[model samples]
Target: MPAFSVMGEFEVIQRYFANSGRARKDTLIGVGDDGAVLQLREGYDLVVTTDTMVAGTHFFPDVDPRALGHKLVAVNISDLAAMGAEPAWLSLAMTLPKVEDPWLAAFADAFSETADYYDCQLVGGDTTRGPMTFTVVAKGQVPHGKMLTRRGAKVGDFIYVTGTLGDAGLGLRLCQGQVEVSKKHSAHILQRFHYPTARLAIGQALRTVASSAMDLSDGLYSDIQHLMHRSAVGASLDIERLPLSQALKDSCDRSTALALALSGGEDYELLFTVPESKKSMLDVLLSPYGVPVTCIGRITGAAGKLELRAGNEPFAYEHRGFEHFEK
Candidate 1:
């Protein structure tokens, strides 16, 4: 029998999830209460994002619990970052087959570590018995009228993405045994996939400069369509200008690497657009964040279309990217 199998739900929660290290002073009532009582900052707009990970669909049955914990918090924080918000609180709901003390302890510790890194408090949550699945509801705040969105792009805006793309896609391939990589490159690739950084500082910095913005949870080819649709614009992506990491380049053919950059999901990097006038100062604006921002495309007058180009030559690309459901 498992060590924690004899413990009841409340006991498990009290021992593992309650009184987390990330507790905030503004949280009037936290984990022990029926609901959380949090004081929202005055003169600020509240932002919220939620994400769920199921064992079979999102990860392998034997994936590391600690990495899973950090990824959960980071991905939701990435959403808040895309909206130019500062993370404030989190609520976790878990469905588990059983409570294994070692696994639960590692998972909760890492979860609290990431939440605390963002200065967010775990205010309240629920636990239940079922197939393993984790859901996080993250709350944040942004200055009034300063939250970024996907609705502000215009024709002539320059499209940019932070950090490198496709590394996580390549990492997924490594995990699935679909590719072979040098030992030195494998760790970097896997880290990119399992522990993505939320570009909060860069996103906050862009609130004043970007015409429109969002984080790339889905592949660029799929997620950029949201920005185009909301802003009623099209885009021309320069294939040769896509940002790719050295690990990604070394792992696959050029075409394959670029394809992954376009089609892979969970990079958790910010994608935003700048007007022509602001392009001159883009580097100066984002330099403090230490994330390389690449201009690989431009919003175009051709509404609703994504045009791919290799320099001046128009190129065709596979029209599919990662999507939850397909007909």
Candidate 2:
């Protein structure tokens, strides 16, 4: 193997990340500074969220650097989206096993691309040598008193989800070789897993409409339970109403697809509730965005109880979703 020189911390930052992304007007001080100075728009409240992804846990150890970079930023932005905030700035703390210039370049390029696409600027961060891990801190802005929260759902609200579900979960299984799919289907599923899209537009649009909201990171079953718990309400979900991509349906049986949709995590789609009074206006309001929104359930008065039904028959689910500390 050819010998490679390890880049010092400052050298790595200047070479790969200092000038990697576009500048933002709100960023008073950006990369290369001790800390970022940001200008918050008047009447807007800041929303900040952080997420960490570790190799062999959140992703495969051999995952492409570019995809990893995109996912690192996307997941954090998803949190902002769920709160009806517009992504504005990002900070990344990354740990790598080695300092490979080519790998770092690819990662930074994709990371910068993702930031620019979302109109977010990379303000500041740190790097170190350790296991392959990424911690992204994202900042967003939402109009005062308009941000959605997980605690706002009320009884008689309608539960809805943006975009299709379960593709990413199936994609993970395909990557691990636990399931078989055709080449075309595999490509789509893998893309879903590798480049999960944050539903930022839908979230922003629903700020005034949604009663409660959250991004689906821990599978619908687990995430919806979170919303119910936070809002002190119950839900009655229609399993038949869950959305599945054509690719997912083609790759798995109905039962298998439904199971994946329920328990598969990391979809990053928005799961929200809207008052029944506003249901008639949903189509008119959301049609312009072109994102598919499905009403999957209804909020109930029974706090903390979630029921699943399939065509009027009670349904039972075995898997609750991915739990980090399950014994």
Best by lDDT: 2
lDDT of 1 at 86: 89
For residues 1-327, write the lDDT of model 1, one tens digit per residue: 123355765677789877764768888988876798888889998899999998877877788999998999999999999999989999998889988889999999998899889898888777877898989999999999999999999999999999999998888777887789899899999999999989988988888899999999879999999999999999999989999999999989998898889987889999999999989888998888778999999999899999999999998888566432212
* After superposition, candidate 2 runs with Cα above 4 Å error: 1-6, 320-327
Model 2's number of clashes is 0
For all predicted structures, in order, the TM-scores are 0.95, 0.95
RMSD of each: 3.1, 3.4
Per-candidate local distance difference test: 0.88, 0.89
Backbone Cα, N, C clashes tallied per candidate:
0, 0
Which 10 consecutive positions of candidate 1 have the poorest summed lDDT?
318-327
Candidate 1 local lDDT, residue 12: 72
Please state the error at residue 181 of candidate 2 in Å. 1.0
Cα-based lDDT at residue 229, candidate 1 = 97
Question: Per-residue CA lDDT of candidate 2, range 220-268, in tens?
Answer: 9988989999999999999999999999999999988997899888899
Position 275, candidate 1: lDDT: 98
